[model samples]
Each structure stands twice: as C-alpha cells, then as structure tokens.
Target: MSDTYRALTRKYRPTSFEDIVSQDHVSNTIKNAIKQNRLSHAYMFCGPRGVGKTTMARVLARTINEIDSSIDGESLNQTLNIVEMDAASNNKVDDVHHLRESVRIPPQNGKYKVFIVDEVHMLSKAAFNALLKTLEEPPEHAIFIFATTEPHKVLPTILSRVQRFDFKRISVDEIVQRLRKISLDEDISIDEESLHVIAKKADGALRDALGLMDQAIAFCGDTITHNELLQALNVVGTDRLFEFMECVKDHDADRGLELINTLLQEGYDIQEYLIGLTEHLRNLYIAHETSKLYLVEASEETKKRYQQTAGDFSRDDLMRMLHIISEAQIKLKDASQPRIQFEITLLKLIHMERSEQLSELLAGLQELKKNSGNFVAPSQNGSTQKEVKPEPEEQAEKVSEPVDETESTEENLEPQPLNPSTDSEAVGSDGSSPGPKESEIEVEAEAEVDTQIEEEEDDDFDIGAPALITTLARKARASVQSEKQKQTAPSNGAPTETSSEKDLPEKITTEYVQEIWVEYLESLKGDFPMLLHLQMERTKVKKVKGGELHLECDNSFAQKMLDEQSTDLQFKLKEFTGSVLRFNISVGEIDEKDKPMSVYERFKQIQQKDPIIRDIVEIFGAELEY
Candidate 1:
C-alpha cells in the first residue's frame, strides 16, 4: 500500500490536448486556430462540471506558449510562464488589480505568458469591470483563458470580448470506455456491470466517474462486484425500480407498499430512489414510443427487460405515470415524512386507472348509444315486449309500460301540440305532417339519457348496464313514438276534416305569430342542424303586423345567421298560417326577460316535464351543474 497515494481524478488528469477524452470538437478547433496563428486574446470555455472545461483551458494555455511537458512538469503546477487562478477564492476588484499588474511583466521562458482562470463566473461585478479593460486589449505577449460551469453569469461585456467554446457532457459509453482503460492500466479486477454503474453514477462527468472508481477500490479492495459498488455508492438497485413498475402495471397496491418499505429499509435515499424510478419510467416510455432500446441508457439485458415491460402500458398511461412521478419528485422535498409520502405516491400509481385514448372512449360511447336503441323495457306484468312497426292510426296506441285503461283516452294519447293558435301542420316530403312538439320531447328524452351517463362518469362509476338499459329504453320509446306520429299524421292525399278548416283565422295576430315562431324552433330540434335550432332559441318575437314578422337578436352575427335562414322560415310559417309573411330579422336590444334560460335553470324549470332527469342525477351521486 502507498502512503502518499494520488486519487484517480488527480492521477489521471490529461496533460496535453491529445490526451483529453470526448472533447475532439473543442481540441480540433483550438489546434487549427493555433496552427493558423489566429488565437483570440481572451477565450471562454464553458459547460457542465468535470466535462473537461478547465482541463481544456489548461491545455490551451500550455499549447499557446508551446510548452513541452517533458521539460516543463506535466502537471503545469511548477511552470513560470503559465499562471493559474481560481476566481472563487479571489474574486475581489483588488484581485483583478493584482492580475492586471502581474500581466505587465513579460514571460521569462515562453513567447506568450498564459493566464488560466477557473470558475470565472464567480468573479464580482467590480472585478469583471476591472478585468474587462485587460480583456479588450492585452499586451501581445499576454493571453487570457477563462473556464466556467455557468457562462450566463459572466457579464455580457466580458463575454463579447472573448471567443467562446462550449464543451458537451461525455456520453455514458465514452465514460465506460475510459473507466475500462483506467481499470486495466491500474490492474483492478472489476466486473463490466460494476464499471457501467460507476459510469452512469458519474452522469457524463469522467472526473466524477474516476472519483467513484477510487471510492469503490477503497471500499471493495482490488476486486469489485456490481452489488458491492452499489452499496459503496449508496445507490438504489435497478431491480427495486423494476419491481415497483411491475406492481403499478398489475395494480398491486399491496406489493407497491412492500417495495417502498424495502427501499427505505435498505438505506436508499428517498430522492435518489425517486430519481432512479423516474429514469426507469422514462426508459419504458422511450421503448414504448420509439421502440429504440439504444435511446435508453441501460445495459443490453436491461433494455430487453424494458422492451418486454413496455407492452404492459400504453403511451398514454406511461405519460400519466411520468407526470405523477415528476410531481411527487418536486413535492418530496417538502414532505415531513418522506417515507409516508413515497408510499402514498406508489399507491397512487398502483391504483391509477389506465387512461384510454380519446378515440377509443368516443368509439365506446357510440357503441353504447347504438346498443341502447335496441334495448327492450319490461312491462308491468314483468314481460319484455319486442318493439315492432305500428299501423298509421294505432301509432300512439303502443306504449312501453302498462298503464290504466281509463287513462288511455284520445286526450291523454295525443302529443301536446306547440302551436295551439294554428290548425295547419307543417307538411313533410312524405305527405304526412311532422309533429314539432313531439320531436322536442324526443330531444329532451335523449338529453336526459346523456346526462345520466355523464353523472355516472362524474362519480367515477362505470355506467351500470341496468341503469343504462332503463334510460335507453325510455329514449327509444320516445323516439319510436315521435317517428310513428310523423308517419301516421294526415297527409295532403287525405282530406281529413278538422276544426281549423271550419274556422280559419282571417288575420295574423301578434299572439298567433309568437305561437307559430315557438313551434318553428321546436320543429328544428331533431330535423335541422343544432346551430339553426340554437340560434332560433336566442331570437325574440318583436312584432307581427301587415304580413311582416319582426325578430330581434342581441348581436349582428346572430342577426346575419337568422337573416340567412329567414326565407326557409317564411315558408314554414306559410304552411302553418297559410300566409306569405316576410321575416324582418335585425340587431336590436332584446329584453333580458325574453332571453333563453341557462341549462341548469331550464332543467329545474322543466323538472315536471321529466322528473326522471332529477332522479337519475341524484341516484347516480352527481350534481347537474348544467
């Protein structure tokens, strides 16, 4: 054993440009500049720590002065021509003043006196200003080189005066290659997995990797295994992360809790464990999305494991899991009991319902809607009836559930008409009159069924088959009755005698026009596009005189939309009142009282129209906000 032993980081420090690892871009560029004699007076080398920034600066300083390491100590610590300064220790204006005075003296050995400043960003503002003049125009024999982990902190004034070179973090593979070479040169017997763990723990910093290797050698002697290295480094094992993810996939909350207990009991840092778990999830996501195992920084066997586990979760579920894990990572720092918080976080992942794609959810809803239309309702006698097409006059006679025979009168069976003032019905293409009010009832029934399913969704409960069947059956019945009513109404071919034929209105009154306007909106409920129906809902009947029907709206956009549909509306009115009335739609101040009610207010008002909506909303344990 050596008493004056050197740490691996300091022992393996590169002496020349060629000896630096994974910095070819910077080394090549600087070498070309030196060959061309185009060296900038001030150069800034910046990047993450241990990625060879300061090392590159030192090499550049040595190269500029053409100092041969064989003669001039390889460490460059004993050189007279090269000056090294750490800005962190001496960052005052007086330090810059001292440096300014030192640079005035010519080099004693080399043509150029090179100055290397590390952690340059730590300099005070006053120091940077004092150094800025020296940087802008230094003596022909003096050269300044700056290295910093954070270049953004340096003043823009100082940055503009220098030629900047950015260094990148060494990749895991490169770090592993470097570690392997060092291990072989030093006669260390270590497994490949242990080397990989050290490289990954370095996080793209070769110096850190070397330091970790030194620690491993001290703890595990000359021989190192993967398990021993993990313990020496205090890192969580990858197996624990893999097992936790499996528990999440299978929704095994109990197993997830057990994994958390084991992790804490093993003396793993809660934050470090979370970070490793997050990385494990990221690997799974990459495998699932790109199917490129190389994108994940793991061994071949671990990549294969990721590939296999990737199939268990969809991309949407993986994204959600990542989001939850990221939030927990942030919240873990403030948690009073980190173990409890970690356990809760794992349980949340295990209990999380996998997210379904939007298209899949919509497809499911459509399939349910289609199936609901065919569902049969049970009668009072507990017998199910198969719905069949009805005869013309007997259309309204068929009902879904049994009722008292006495209540089955003509008045009870007839659909309440919206247009009580007009006798003529809007004739359809098939020669029968379509009942506008009946279609409105059907629309309301459909809305009720939709709300019921929504209520179930809000409660986080699956739409029960029984509840859906009942709601769908009611909707189906209403739809069928409306369809039959439209088909069975008296057509132009049939000259049926009616009270309207005997007593036709001689004149169009405001009241008559208003009633007809409501029926027009009701008629649009099912047959027309919703925009037209909704627009008509917002209109107010302002006036009706001398064959002119005036409608008012709040905005010009609404007025324009109504104006476009006015001609068709006029035709509808002619069919009802047998009058060619002109529609005058204009932007005007409509009274607040005339505006349509909000959905919640309307539902409350129309509860009597369909009490089942209120019942379903309550029974499903959801508030009908709309």
Candidate 2:
C-alpha cells in the first residue's frame, strides 16, 4: 500500500462532459460551443453547493485550452496557460489588479490563458469593478471561467458580461448509478439498499454521497450493509419511519413516544429524522395514490414496504402528518425542548383523526335516512316517540273524530245574530248557522295541524325533527293539553298509553344497537369531527344487553374521549334506537379487522366491490380523495 488516499469525490469526479450526470443540457451546449468555436470570453457556472459548478468550470478551462483532462496527467499548476484561484480567499481589490496585469500576458504553452475563479461571487465590489475593465477588453489569448453557488451576489454588470450555464442538482437515480459504478471500480461490496440510503441521504449532492460512501467504507471495511450505513451516518432508516407510522395506524402513542426516545438515544438528529420522515411520507403518498413507483427512490424491498404501508393511511392523514412534521421542523429551530417538540409531534400523529370521505358521508347519510324509519325523536315530556307513519285506519279515525265532535258542538250551539260589528261576519246575511262554533273552529284547526304534520313526516322522514320540534310543539300544544286534561280526569278508568310507550322496542338487541351506533357515528361526522374520531371510529360494540350497552375501545385515548362524551353519546343512542340504553364503556381488546381502514385500503375495498368503480380506477387512474 502506498499509504496515500484520494477521497471518492475527487477520485470519481467526472473529467469529461459525458461523465457528468443530470446536466446534459449544460454539457451538451458547452460541447457544441467548443466544437463550433463559439466560446465566450467569460463564462459563469451557477448552481447549488456541491453540484459540479467548480468542477465544470475547471473542465471548461481544460477543454477550451486543449489541455488533457486525464487524472494521470501532470498537474495543470505547472502550466502558465491555465490558472485556478479561490476567489473566496483572494477577493480583494489588489488580487483583481494582479489578475488584470496577468491577463495582459500571452499564453505560455496552451492556446489561451484560462483563469478559473471558484466562488467568484465572493469578490468585493471594487474587485468586481477592477475585473469589469479586463473582462470588457480581454486579450485574444485569455479566457475567464467564474463559478459560484450564489450567482446573484455577482454584480449585474458582471453577470451580463459572462455566458451563464446553470448546473442542475443530480437526480437520486443518477447519483445511485454513479455510486454503484464507483463501488464496483473500488472493489467495495455494498447492497442496493445501502446504495439507496446513501443516495437519498446525499439529497442530490454527489459529493456528499461519495463522502458518505467513503465514511461507510472506512467504517465497514468495504462490505457495507444498510444497517451499518445508517449507523455510520447516524441516520434513522426508513424502517424507523415505517415503525412510527405503524404505531400511528395502531393508535399506539406509547410506541410513538418510545420511537422518539429510541431515536434520541441512538444519537440521531431530530431535524434530520423529520426531513427523512417527510420524504418517506411523500413516498407513501405517491405509492398510495399513483402507479409511479419509480418516483420513490429506494430498493425494491423498501418500495414494496412503502406500497403496503401506504394503504394504512389516507391522503388526508398523510397530509396532516406531513403538516405536523413540517411544523415541528420549524418549531425545532426555536423550541426550548426539541425532544419534547418531536414527542408531541409524534403523539399528534398517533392520535390524529382519520379523515371521512364525502362519499362515505353521503353513504352514511343515505343509510341513516334509510334506517330513519326505525328512528324516533324524544318527546318534550322526556319520553321517546317512535316516528311511525300513522296507519290509514288511524288517519280515518282522527279526521272522523274531529268532524263528529264538530257536528256535536254545532248541534249544541244555539243560533245567534250575524254580529256584523264583530270580527266574525255571517254568510249571505242568513245568520242561520251563526258564524261558527268555537269548538268546531278548534276541531278544524286541530285537523289542519295534524294533516300538515303527517305530510311533513311522510316527505322528509323527520331527519330535521330536532330543528323543527319547537315549531311543531307550538302547533300541537292545544291537542297535547286537551289530551292531558282527559288523562287527568278523576274517574276510575284505566290509564291510556302514549305513542312512545307503545312503540318502544320491547328489548334492545345487538343488531339494532349496532345500527343505532352507526347512525350516531354518521351524525357526528358532519358537526363533530373530533368527537366522531374519538368516540366512534375506535370503539366497537362489544355487546348490548337490555338497557346496558357495553363498548370496547382499543386504547385509553379513545376510552377517555368516549368517557368524556358518555352523557351526550348515551342520549344520542337512546334517541336513535328509541331505547334508553346506558353505555358500559371499557378500554379493552378490539379486533384488528374492526380497526379503521386507511384511505387507499378503503378505496381498494370499494374498487373490489363495484365494477364501475374498478373500471373508473383502472381507466382514469382515479384515487380515493378526501
């Protein structure tokens, strides 16, 4: 061994334009310029850090001056024709003055004197002004190439004088391909997952990826695995992200907290973890909603994992999770306790609500309406009334009773004068029937109100009964009071039962209770999303016995939420089922199949069930939207 080490970034740096990755536009243009002899006097290479700006500047310098770019060649520093300067350190007015003087001299060996100024934006204002004169009137044998990450910092006049070539950030696939080539050349053994991890961790910077690969080689001695790479780089793998999301899907806040703690213990940066997490969620969203698996830059196994897990979360949940993570990332910069912030973020994701789709809501509404025939609103006297459509016999009896009472009252009323001065005026000046009897008028009014109520019930099915209850109460108050008076009459007769008492379910069953349970949940989604999540989605109907309804929840968070809303939930339950059933809620075991399905999984199920939906999904690439 020579005991000499050249880092992979420098060793594998692209020497020819063909070797440069993902910058074909710039490379191709430059090659054409070189071939056609259309080279500008000065060129500016601009892009992000570590994105081949300086490298391209040097390559252009060598290419234009007819110097060999082979790594085995003698150093270019020996030639007076090609010069490289670090403008970051040599950016004073005096440096530019010296450069101006050097430009006056002809090339010593090459066709032109090429000056490659890295970080040229660091040049001072006076230095740029000094350079402007030399650039405006450059020698025939001199060429200038300036490279900078921030091109805006260069004076606009200086920018206008130079031809600019923007280098794009290398794609993950290109970086991975380059890294694989390097690994093979260097005789290093690394798995595809390891390469993917390094490529993604590079974040479009090939130099950073090479640096990480060198670090991994030094740490792992050529045989690199994904786990070792993660350990060496101090990065949390996507497996950790998968685990965290699994915790979220299961609603296991404890596991979520533990994951955060484990990451902290492993010496992983929370900010980096959050960045990786955001990308992972993005990948999951892409995998869930689209067929473009190539968009996810990962190994086959990881991509499959992403696809499988993508079904465990809805797009809304993913979006919210991403939002939470982004907020945490921002807050972490100013947070007094970063770990706590991260913990809180994870907990929020774990306890986050699953979004209800509009179609699901509409379906639920339809089901509620379809089942509303069995539903009843509670009466004003704290009693339940079944919303039954009155039988034809009952309708006939009601109208006939009112008419009979009206006729009897009319027969009893003596004939009176027309009373033209009063509000009531007799017809035809006859005064034979007087204007109308008070009891007959009352019967007519009662009959009219009854007809209107029956018509309303027949049409809308009393879905808005609660909202209209007060109005209906005012209209029926007279009839109710009259019925009460008859009921209170001091006679040794048997008491009559009300409609509520007669229509109440003789015994509550699990099936009816579940139907009411579903209806109650549907009612919450529109008005109380949070309540629906807490009390509805996570709770299961364990059993319904008599007046006691036992419910089992998977976690304490849901149990606590249910407990807090127990009173209102029980009331709603009774209202929907027409039985005063009490909730016996307990935090206990729940079946996995009964758990809430993610958006993609639900859509998949729907697609499987409906051929039209399946065809639409296949034809139009339709995704389940929130």
Candidate 3:
C-alpha cells in the first residue's frame, strides 16, 4: 500500500492550549478556568474562520475528558468522555433530541461528559428550542461547548445559557511566525518575502497560512520564492500595484490601462485584482500618517514600499482613489463586460487629479494680494486708509513758497500815509513799490490748505473704487479658473473653449437688451438657482450680437441649466433690456489675468488709460442650481 502525505495545516493542527497560534488570551483564559475548577456547563466560542475557535473547543473537550496527550510523548490518558457533532448537517429537531438523550446518562468512565458542536448557529429554530431545556439545566457531570463563525444568528436563549468568549482575527505577523516554524520543522525552504505573501494571503488566519504554505511547498518543489508564491496564489505583487497607482496619480491613463490588461492576461481574477489594489491603497493611506508601519502587519520590505509610495500621494488623492475603486467594484459585478468596467475605472483613476487643497488656494490668494497691492489697513475712524506719495516734481510744486513782495511794498509806503495824507499820495504810495495786504496772505494760505485736502480725498476715492472692484473680480476669476483647470486639465490639455464661447454674448450692453436679459434672469429666480446665481454674479452689460444676449456662469452645470430654460429667459431678458434679445450662454470660467480694474481705479487711471468693468459686482452667496 502507498503511504499518503498529510496536509501541513491538518498535520500541524493545534492539539493543546499552548500549540494554538495567535490566540494566547483565549487559550490562557480557558486553561485558567479549567485549573480553577470553574468550568461552565455550556461554553460558546465565536470568531472568524480558522482563528482556532473550534480548535480551542476540541482542546477543551480533550482536556476535560482526560484524553491522552501523547503528541509530545507526555501521556496523561485517563478516559474518553467527549463527543463532537457538526451542527450544520445535523440541525434537525430529531438530532437535538438524540443529542439530549445521549447527554442524559453520564460518561462510562470519565468524570465529565462533554459535547462539542461546531457551527452551532446553523441549527434550526426547532432544534434550538429542543436543545434549550437540556442546555439550561444539564446534569452536574455534563458539558456542552458550541463554536460558530457568526454568533448573531445563534438563538438568544441558547446564548444566554452559555458562557460566551469572542475570538479576535490573528495578526499577519503571528501567521508568519507560525509558518516559519512549520517550514523549519517540515524542512521546506522559503524566503522571508514569500512567507510574507502567504501570510497576507491568509488574511489573519493561522490555519489559512499553514494551508497556503503547504500548497506553496508542494507546487514549488519544496523551495518557494516570492515570485513562486505570487504565481501560486495569482497575486499581483506589491511593486507592480504601486507602479499602477503611481501611473494613476500622474494622470497617465494609457499606462494604467496597460497594466490592467497585462494583469488580466496573466490569469488573475479581475474583481479580486481590484479588491487587492483597493487594500494596497488603504494600507498606503494608513502608512502615510503613522510612524508604526510594522503595526500594518506587512513585512519589513513591504512596509518600506508602502511608506515610499505613500509619500508620492496626498491623503485626499488616496481617499479619492479608494472611493473610485469601491464604486467600480459595485458596477463590475453586474456589468455586461467586466473587463470593460475595469478598463473604464482604471482610466478614471489615472485621469483623476486631486482637487486643489484649500490651503493651496488660500496661499495663492495671499500671493496675489502681495503682487496687486489690494490689502487695505483700517484707519482710526474705522474707515480704510490708502497711502499715496506724489512724484518729486509734484511734491516740489505743492510745497513751494509764494514770492515775498510784502517787504518791498512796505519799504515803498510813504510816512505821510500814517497821518491820513492826501488822496494823490495814498494812491501813488505803491506806484514805486507795492506793500503786502493781510487779506491776500490769508487767501493764499486758505487756498493751499484746501488744495492739499482735495488731493488727499481724491487719492482715497481713487484707491477705494477700482481697488475694491478689482479685488472682487480677481477672486471670483481665480476660483472659477482653478475649478475649470481641474476639470479640463486631465482631458489631454484641451481647453473648454467651445463651452466658454457659448456662454459669452457680444454687444449686449444696449439698454433695451440689458433690461430684457435682466427680466429673463429674474423670472428664473424660483425655477433655477444656477441661473439666478449666475445672474447675481454677472453685472456687466455685453453688447447684443445677432439678437442674442450672452452671459457667463461658473460651471457647466449652471450653463446646462440655463440652456434648458432659454425660451422663458429670453422673453424676460427682452422685457428688461428693451430689446428682443435671444440667449447666448457663455460658460467661460473666469480668467484671473484678464480681469478689468475697479470703477474707481479706472477713473484714477484715466491718464494710465486702463478701462474698468462698467458694472457692480454681483454677489450671490445662496445655493443655486441651473
């Protein structure tokens, strides 16, 4: 007869409390209970599959029944008193009655009779009720132990009667350590990286680790490398997945799609590949913020890879990618062609750019303020102050003194004028030299003071009008342009010129046309928020062209919404502008660079010949949709 090989997982199954891996707390607690003579009549163990819950239960049975422990040549045989049942297949009321009857009589030789039921939650309601009476009040010598992966499905009455212990998922490190020991004892040669892969593939299950290791050894002829492990499990390695993620981050859609196609050609499951990629990204996210990378349950090399990859992405980008992948997962299941779904999802990820961080936006604003000199400091009177310094020539002209002719005139005045001299003498007194008059000096001082005050007031008004308008326009334009760039930059650098042109109308400033468009937009006050908001932001009157009034909005959604309500909008605009204006909606995002100066600034800059936007800034803070 030919000898058969036992699987490593079954051959190395935990037989004693000390042999169970990654479950010291549970095993130690059970051991102490036995030692203290405080064992419960009914015990429940619940956790994920292969975490040693059932194994612990079996060990408990053997311990209580006093079965021989001869694995390590330490025999402690006393008597057999434990019976095990698979409740999944035998969940009938009759089965429960049979079990109850069997537990009635005491063990033939042992002190306690133990019954171990695996998957106890699978028992039908009738079976559970049938077993309840015996479970609640069993004989002093009887013990009932139940194990289940899902404890919520178990009857509450049965649960209330039993002492429950919840089990935890094993860490990857624990699984790796157990596999290393097995490899050593079994004389199988495998690299640390291969062991890491197997452990991760096991996903917090020691038994699963053993099983995978057994399979790896068998398939790879006793020596397993990282590549061998990957082939055996069909896993795309961490490095390739990270490369794919990098491509996505860089907006390289072609490269990302190529990677997906390559993996699919390698016989990997599309869904499983996506799921693994999602997990890889999640780990990277966790690693980005944490110094304790080891706690992520990856090998040293894998942890390093994660840390390096995490440095390439912002947290927001990683989160966005995770969301996209998750949504793709749902769509792929019912998709007509799963591969196409994956391709489309990959393209989306690769072409996706992270939204500008609010910090970056604020920083840009600060930079613009520094460049444009728009910041105004508040004055003592609570009004804003603007400092102005005149040119050297202008200053010289302002502070120059008037000629001093008063002294000359006084020298020419005759002494007879003091004694009320003749009329001829008084009239001829200043003929040779004129004397200064008090009224003339006073008039000159008052005129100079008035001129200085007027100049100061004009400077303040000049800064206030144009500066305020320019500041508002620049901000509005920057916000709109940034958003537009984000939306269009990933689409091969093609600007949305068509959409921009469609939203702008030519020569729509005539009073008749202006009134018509205003009435049209106002009519949509209740019907469309986007149109209303757009109108609120737009105040300039563009000249009408081809009987159409053009207006700009911040985004495409607003543009589309306005387009849908064009007819009603056109009629109202005609009424307000006094022209039969058709609608030409220009969805041009703001151009920060081309924004005109404020009205006040423009007036001051008449010498500079800079034109100002000829309208008030429209302010609409309310939420609107078009």
The numbered model that scores best in TM-score is 2
Error of 2 at 465 (Å): 14
Candidate 3 on 81-177: residue-level lDDT in tens? 6777889999999999889888888888768888889899999999999998999999999999899998999989989999999889988777888
Q: Write the per-residue lDDT of candidate 2 for residues 1-626, one digit (tens) a residue.
A: 12589888877777777777788888889899889988889989898877787777667767777777663222665678877888999999999988888899999777889888889999999999989988977988888889998988999999999999888888888888999988888889999888888888888888899999999999998689878889999988888888988898999988788888888888998889889899999999999855798888888888898889999877777887887887788889999988888888878888876786443544445435543554566779975555545447544444433222332234334455445575344444554445465444445655655555546544443342221222453336335445545645568776766554465576778886776566577555312323234347657898887678898876554565566667756765665667567888887854676455655666788899999999998899875322
TM-score, structure 2 vs. true: 0.62
CA displacement after TM-score superposition, residue 517 of candidate 1 (Å): 43
Each prediction's TM-score versus the true structure: 0.61, 0.62, 0.58
Looking at model 3, which ten-residue stretch has the lowest summed lDDT? Answer: 617-626
Ranking by lDDT: 2, 1, 3
lDDT of 1 by residue, 1-626 (tens): 34688888877888788889999998999999999998888889999999998788777877777777664324675677788889999999999999999899999887888888899999999999999888899999888989999999999999999989999999988888898999888888997777778888999999999999999999998899888889999988777778888898788888778778877788889889878878888888898755477778767877788888889987767776777778889898898988888888778888876654343444344434543443356678974543323234333243322222222335434555546464455556677766444444444444444344445433442322222123333344445545554556687757554443454478878888777677666655433334455567778888887778888876554566567667766765675677778988887764677444443445566565777876776689534310
* Global lDDT of model 1: 0.73
User: Superposing every Cα of model 1 onto the true structure, what RMSD results?
Assistant: 17.6
Following a full C-alpha superposition, what root-mean-square deviation does model 2 have from the true structure? 15.5
What is the Cα-based TM-score of model 1? 0.61
Clashes within 3 Å, all models in order:
0, 0, 36
Model 3 spans > 4 angstroms off: 1-3, 71-80, 355-626
Off by over 4 Å in 1: 1-4, 70-75, 289-291, 356-365, 373-626
Ranking by TM-score: 2, 1, 3
